[model samples]
Target: MLLNDRVCVITGAASARGIGKATARLFATYGARIAVLDLDAGQAEEAARDIGPGHIGLACNVTDRAACDRAAEEIVARLGRIDVLVNNAGITQPLKIMEIAPENYDAVTDVNLRGTLYMSQAVIPGMRGQGSGAIVCMSSVSAQRGGGIFGGPHYSAAKGGVLGLAKAMARELGPDGIRVNSVTPGLIQTDITGGKLTPELKVEIAKGIPLGRLGVADDVAKACLFLASDLSAYITGAVIDVNGGMLI
Candidate 1:
């Protein structure tokens, strides 16, 4: 158990088929106490129950700094100290730039970019006080290759910002024994994409990937666990690609 006895906080963990939920489950399996944060209080609580005891669920609007701070405080109160922070709360809007609405763009940026910043900021104090911690931000292959398959321009831009933020935070926090990194996943099959992908579209995407398949939530979660563990102690400001050779 690489994360044995550690406490990990994962945002956007309520959805049954979300990457955040998979990451939370993986962290729990590795013996970490989890704090599952999501916008839906009931769903978050249900997720916590599914993960079994010794875990907690909290309602948090990651876009709101005050709410994020409160959630972090609540987690600390229950779990003692936070050892890992995963900024995984995000959303996507699939529309062409010309057709995209201002509200859609704002919504995507608010959750994907601003939300990541708020969550990271809220947890930095606790991690700094502990003298050691890891932070993982969820970027996307769309950020690197410009959203050929997944999200719209705004979504790609926001995810790109997440990568940049992770790198900057890594440099600033490294001396304090806190490491920051980002993971970019490619064409992952989650509830977010299920509604958008037709049978023909899924086949088209699979053919483009060298691995011959779309990515699963576990693929990203495994990469996250690696970054969260001491195995990555010397690594910071690094972007791990969990894209199954889609970008290569």
Candidate 2:
């Protein structure tokens, strides 16, 4: 139990098959108390319940700073202190540069970039005072490769911003005993489209990946667990690629 008796907060963790939820479950099994935050109140509570006892869920719109602050306070008040934060709240859009409307750009950037910032801000003070903490930010292979299987130019730009923000935070917060790192996942198969990926499309995508398969939510979650646990205690400002040699 690498995270035994620790308290962890995971954002955007409501979806039954999303990476955030998988991370939450993995952390919980490691003996950590989990705080599952999502935009949907009911879903958040339900997800937490699904994780079993000694966990909680809260409704939080990560794009809203006030909501982020409140969530942080509430978690600390109940769980005593936050030892890890997974900034996993994000959204993506599948559109070209010219096809991206103003609304589309705003929605994608706000949730992926702004949400990460707000949530981090909410947790830093406690981590700083405690003199130790870990933060795992979620990026995407799209940011590194300039495009992903389902995201557009705007999505890439947003995730790229996340990479920069995580690195900068890691550098600034290292002295305070807080580690900040990122996970860049490739195309992960989730319930995003309700199993709409045709078998032919899956085969075509797998052909390009050296691993001969698409990624699952658990693959990225395991990377996050490594970063969040003591295994990577000496690492910070690093970007762990969970893309299965997609770039190679």
- For TM-score, the strongest prediction is 2
True-vs-predicted CA distance for residue 48, candidate 2, Å: 0.5
**TM-score of every candidate relative to the true structure:** 0.98, 0.98
Which stretches in model 2 have alpha-carbon errors above 4 Å?
A: 193-196
lDDT of 1 by residue, 36-82 (tens): 99998999989998998999999999999999999999998999999
lDDT tens per residue, model 2, 115-146: 99999999999999999999999999999999
lDDT of 1: 0.93
Clashing residue pair totals per candidate (backbone < 3 A): 0, 0
TM-score of 2: 0.98
Worst 10 residues of 2 by lDDT: 188-197
Q: Tell me the spans in candidate 1 whose CA falls farther than 4 Å from its real position.
A: none
- Give the distance in Å from residue 16's predicted Cα in candidate 1 to where it truly belongs: 0.3
